[model samples]
Target: MIRLPENTTVFDDGEAVARAAAGHLRTLCEDAPNQRFAVCLSGGSTPKRLYTLLARPDYATLPWSRLHWFFGDDRAVPWDDPLSNVRMVREAFGTPSPIPETHLHPIPTADGPEAGARRYEATLKAFYGAETLDPARPLFDLVLLGLGEDGHIASLFPGKAALDETRAWAAAVPEAGMTPFVPRVTLTYPVLASARSVLFLVSGAGKQDPLARLSQGEDLPVGRIGGSPLWFVDRAAAGA
Candidate 1:
């Protein structure tokens, strides 16, 4: 419920953001050296730099073999489409992504939206079936998210029914309001709030207005995620 530039790390540029991300990854893996990192990755230009950095050899120092990667949200596009978050991650990572297939959880975009969402749910259940962990917690130790210009996080756009969804930690987005109308796959509010930590990676001049509105509790999707979330922003994005 509080926003403080001093609380979260602020990077001046994309390079700095990448370094911070790599450093965070290193620290997280250090604590659980033998355990897999159940991380949820964000998609967007803001995180593209981090993705490339992580896929590199230096960033690959982590026990990639034991890393588990999951997407926080995905567009309802075919697997090969440029908009596919899965493909973007696969492409960003060089030869060895350090993550094994058993750990990579990409949405089933190929089968179409409805089926894709259903299949992804099964995937999640299969992974944490007996853990007794709620749909949101522990799915990811750290969830990296990006704030949309409209204050939307993941596929939970402003005023969309998805924001009101309470059934599962993850849900299928079938509202045709979104331009593409492709089924979007995303983690629900409970799951988001359940995460051990949530980091909002926001860096862009176009985001100032929305960020201002969110700060005022304008009832945006991004505003709903109010558990003292950590934010990463550039000077320009902050309009400071």
Candidate 2:
């Protein structure tokens, strides 16, 4: 059985998890001290629901103008591909979404994973206005993450060299740990760690083992996340 961390918040179901995550995001945006709030989005069914909720009229008060959206990882496929995180996000938000076109920064993957990773890193550096990350100043206000059954966070899979990367803000995963098996570009740990808040949204019974391993003090990629990360999981994922 998984012994959930003290920071974990168990929800009744996946829908409740999405709702609570939406609320947490709203609070974070509202309370942000900076004029511009950056958010790193995660990809998954659970987060897709959260993104859809944010795009709805009910979340109109979320200050869309000041909030910038970014992706933590994406497959090296066309933006419109079904497996593409960019496609999923665009479809979830629907037409006439409040987020400005310039505000949604998708990882560039058309030029292949290597160049795409480099370009995306440049984009992030430009947005941060500095090449070097300062611990005192975070690159993002909130970062949303999902726990893979293999304990991978973003595209940094177990035993992958990307897990040891300490320089670049983003790195290319030429070979993924699992399907869709396409090449991917992912933000490195330092970039992810440079967020004011990191929230892991996990659901489904399949996630129980990973959570259990984390509880047992296994050094999964998720464990390397800084900033005192919090977990928001459904009962099934918590091994309830």
For candidate 2, the per-residue lDDT at 181 reads 89
Highest-lDDT candidate: 2
Candidate 1, residues 101-158, lDDT tens digits: the string is 6778898877666677678767766776642456444666778888787778889987
Candidate 2's TM-score: 0.97
Q: Output the worst ten-in-a-row residue range by lDDT, candidate 1.
A: 1-10
TM of each candidate vs. truth: 0.89, 0.97
* Local distance difference test scores for all models: 0.74, 0.91
| Error of model 2, residue 164, in angstroms | 0.4
**Shift of residue 203 alpha carbon in model 2, Å:** 0.7
RMSD in Å for candidate 1, one decimal? Answer: 2.7
Backbone atom clashes (below 3 Å) for every candidate:
2, 0
Error of 1 at 225 (Å): 1.9
Model 2: residues >4 Å from true position, as ranges?
none
Task: For candidate 2, write residues 1-240 as lDDT tens digits.
Answer: 589876899998888999999999888977885589999999998999899988888998888888999999999999999999999999999998789999999999999899999999999999999989999999999999999999999998988889999999999999999888899999999999898889989999999998889889999988887668888999999878
